[model samples]
Target chain A: MKTQSILLKQRPEKTPQNSDFEFKEEEVSTPKSNEVLLKSIYISVDPYLRGRMRDVESYIEPFQLNEPITSAIIAKVEKSEHENFKEGDYVLGHLAWKEYQVAKGENLRKVDPKQANLSAYLGILGMTGLTAYFGLTEIGAPKEGETVLVSGAAGAVGSTVGQIAKIYGCKTIGIAGSDEKIDLIKGKFNYDEGINYKTTDNMKEAISKAATNGIDVYYDNVGGEILDATLQNINRNGRVINCGAISQYNKDETATGPRVEGILIKKSVKMQGFTLQNDFGEKFNEGTKKLAQWLQEGKLNYEETIREGFEKVPQAFIDLFSGENKGKMVVKVAEE
Target chain B: MKTQSILLKQRPEKTPQNSDFEFKEEEVSTPKSNEVLLKSIYISVDPYLRGRMRDVESYIEPFQLNEPITSAIIAKVEKSEHENFKEGDYVLGHLAWKEYQVAKGENLRKVDPKQANLSAYLGILGMTGLTAYFGLTEIGAPKEGETVLVSGAAGAVGSTVGQIAKIYGCKTIGIAGSDEKIDLIKGKFNYDEGINYKTTDNMKEAISKAATNGIDVYYDNVGGEILDATLQNINRNGRVINCGAISQYNKDETATGPRVEGILIKKSVKMQGFTLQNDFGEKFNEGTKKLAQWLQEGKLNYEETIREGFEKVPQAFIDLFSGENKGKMVVKVAEE
Candidate 1:
């Protein structure tokens, strides 16, 4: 049998283009002992992948040239030689951008389609959700009656963060690139206020108006001037959780904005950054259980902008930098 | 009796000059029901005082126009009217830059001169020491074998920070303006390495060479290019303690360096700033007792740049900006 895969063809200088990826067909072999043959159902395309494209040392290893790009994917087990996994079970694994993949059973986590949508395992009940949970609760630590301002509030991790902050009894303010995002976050995600950074002339002034009590926690997803502007309104002992800097991901040079050390000194602010495996590897089961419970209780809501077919995976990733997706960006390859 | 006090004659635009202060003789009044007559012994001149001179809302209120600048001072109770009564008892209080003054008994904490030198109460065994202890252990939290890079390592807080980090079994690298500071930190403060930022053409290169491993903690005292330079070398999960920004205090404009939000995101670093009262108001006694214990165990050593006479208090404060002090900058006003 044959499976189509996307491979990294070239290293991008700035923003990645469709030409940077090459689509090819590869033969799928029978699963070896302790391995499972996965039929890919969905593949996640995240903004953090932009960092993996560069030939630099980062939180994770950079994707090597001419290799099939890999990420979190929801797959069905077509064949299994491992004792832990069965042939008909649905699983989530760090598999390739392909239709069929052979992965070690240990790398595959079984998911229940009955509890939540299988695609959610790629998003709200997965790494994206956990990033929001750990980064906010552990680092940001928003308190009741405090104000939390989340940048990129319409995206996967950000949307979850704003909702969770709301659940924590914080007055949540979201910053997004468009008015649509602002409305979605405010209306559907339960954010108390939303500021459209694209339309707002002065973000600092807008935030000052929205967060009248002053920002006690800043959950940052989009870094650049917005992050810089938010620094102006942070109250004493304010916390800034740096989850991702999507605005600077495609930049040719190292991104720069207003220096923060001076403001940090003045306000006694704490700004921290983290990735999932690095920070929450041990707490994954605990985090996912809580997230699942939140979803089951209908206190949490999630959205996914899914592109159909395996051929569109590369385009889906490139679209992330342009702010094309409302929530988690995923590519659907096959039916369950 | 009349006592000489240095009053703020003018608010400085940049670096404070001698003309900005006016010396006046004020009548020392007898203590009332809960007040005590205080004779100034050792007066602390700190970098944070530079912020108080400006008309800005900071952690502490800005020093009032034409009012005597108040700071940590070791004083002797010349007369007492409270039941807590003590004659010839040395005390520490937020007293003015005056040779003699009256203070409420509630603001005074009696210091035992028999335990350590009365001057030590103003430096290592006092607020300066406590600042280092809490900021380092609580925020910086440098683990064993980690590399700790401290800027302005020859100053009061920086000197103490390097020593405490050394005691924690971390490799300490210090950055200071002159070769004298570099040598002092390396030799006396027991820093593993030292970088003379003023003499070094490329501070990043210098740090790269000295800190063979990436920096795990950055104790920032003189924030400017050095703070910017150190960001490049910070390892993943690094901690940056924003103690002071003496380098930028005299600037006519808000100081700006390379924006740190992006780097902070990439490394998952936590950069935090604090003042003693803002962070450790309730835990001051606990921190000081631990500091005093370290002093008694000979696990900690301290140095002070003592400028003689109350007349030099303003000059001594000005000198802090010019990098004239080796350790804690204090003005010795009276004999023990």
Candidate 2:
């Protein structure tokens, strides 16, 4: 059997270009004993993948040049020689971009389609939900009556963060790039107020005006001048969860901003950065349980901007940099 | 009695100048019931006072034009009508720069000269020691065998941080402005190595060379390019304690540096800032107890650069910007 896969043709200098990726053809190998032949159903494209594209040291290793890119993918088992997995069963794992691949059954987590939609496994019920849950609850620690501000307010983690902050009984404010995104977060996600960064001239003053009381927790998914503006309006003992810096991910040179130590000391704030895999070790089950409970009770909501076809995975990831996705961005390849 | 006092003549645009202060003569008021006429004996001049001189709001109120400058002072009770204090007793309080002033006895803490040197109350056994102790143990949280780096390693808090890190069984590296200060930190304070940032062309490379292994904990007192340099060499799961920003305190405008969120998230680091007052409410006794025990056990040592005379207080403070004093800068006003 044959399959098509996308590989990192070249590392990006500034913003990622389509030329950075290459589509290749490869023969799918037969499953060995204790291994399963899996078909990729849905693929997840995230902003953090940009960091892994660079040749640098981090919690996660950089992607090797000319190798297939890997991310969270929902797959279906077509043939299983292992006891844990059966044919036609849906599963999720950190798998490659290939349409069909063989993997050991133990490396994949069995996901029941009845538990949630198969596409949902790539988002709300999986990594996206976990990132929002742990990043907000563990670091943000929003308290009732406290003001919570979120940047990248319409993206996968940001939308969930705004909703979770509201559930904690806190007044939530969001900063997104578009007026439409602002409306979505405020109307559907229960954010008390929203500021469109592209339209607003003075974010610091705008954030100050919207927050009124002051921001006690800031879930930072888009870091740049917005983070600086939020710092200007942060209250004493504020917590800043550095989940992602989507704004800086594509810059050719490292960006410069106002020094933070002066403000951090003056406000006694804690700015901590974490990736889901590195910081979420040994606690995924706990986070998954809470997120599932919130979803089951209707206290939580999720949005997936799913693009169809396996060949469009690269373009789907490229669209993330342009603010083209509303919520969770996932690509659907096949029906489970 | 006639006494002199220094008042805030103007708000400094950049570095504080002698012209920013005005000396005025005032008649010493006689003690009333529950009041004590205290004569200033020793005064503390710290770098954080630069922040108070600005017209902006901070953790503490900013200084007002024409108001008397105030700081930690050890004074002698010249005339007392209060139950807690008597004539000739030494007391410590956040007092004015006046040679003699009337204050309520309850506002002051009585200090015994027999227990320690009068200046020790202003530095080692006082705010300076507490700042280093809590800033390191609470935020830095250095574990045994870890590598700890201190910027402004010869300053009061930095010197103490280097020593405390050594006491914690961690490898310590010190960064200072001068070679002599570097020698003092390494030879006297027992730092494993030293980096003279002033002469070193590249601080990041120098820090990497000195640390050998990447930096595990960074106690930041001098926040500027050094902080930016330190971030480049931080290890996985590291902690950055922002104690003071002396390098930035005198700047006319806010300083700009490389944005840290990307590095912080990549390294899973925590950057926290605090002051002695806001973060330490009821925990003073706990910190003071541990610090005093180390002093008594000969496990700790302190450096005090004592300048004599009363009228030199303003100059002593202005000199803090140029890095004039070695460890804790204190001025002696009168003999005990």
RMSD in Å for candidate 2, one decimal? 1.2
* Candidate 1 per-residue C-alpha lDDT over B1-336 given as tens digits, one digit per residue, 9 for 90 to 100: 999998988898889999989999989889999999989999999888888888878888888888998999999999999768588988999899999999999988998888998888888988889889889999988899999999889888889999999999999999888888888888889998998887899988999999999899999997788888888888989899998877788885555567677777788888999878878889988988888888889888889999999889999999988899988989999987
Candidates' chain A TM-scores:
0.98, 0.98
Error of 1 at A330 (Å): 0.8
| Candidate 1 runs further than 4 Å off | none
Q: Could you give candidate 2's per-residue lDDT for residues A1-336 as a string of tens digits?
A: 999989999998888888999999999999999999999999999988998999988788899999999999999999999899999988899999999999888889998888778877777778888888888898888889999999988988888988988889999999889898988998888889999999999999999999999999999998899999999999999989998888889984468988899999888999999878878868999988888888899887778899999988989999999999999999999876
Docking class of 1: medium
Q: Against the true structure, whose TM-score is highest?
A: 2
Interface RMSD of 2: 0.9
DockQ of predicted model 1 = 0.72
Error of 1 at A100 (Å): 1.6
User: DockQ (C-alpha) of model 2?
Assistant: 0.86
lDDT by residue (A1-336, candidate 1, tens digit) is 998889999998888999999998989888999999999998999888888899988888999999999999999999999999898899988888888888899888899899888999999999999999999999998899999999989999989999999889999999988988988998889999999988999988999999999999999998788888898898999999988888888885555566677788899999998877887799998999989899989989998999998888888898998899999999888998
lDDT of 2 at B225: 91
Model 2, position A299, has a per-residue lDDT of 82
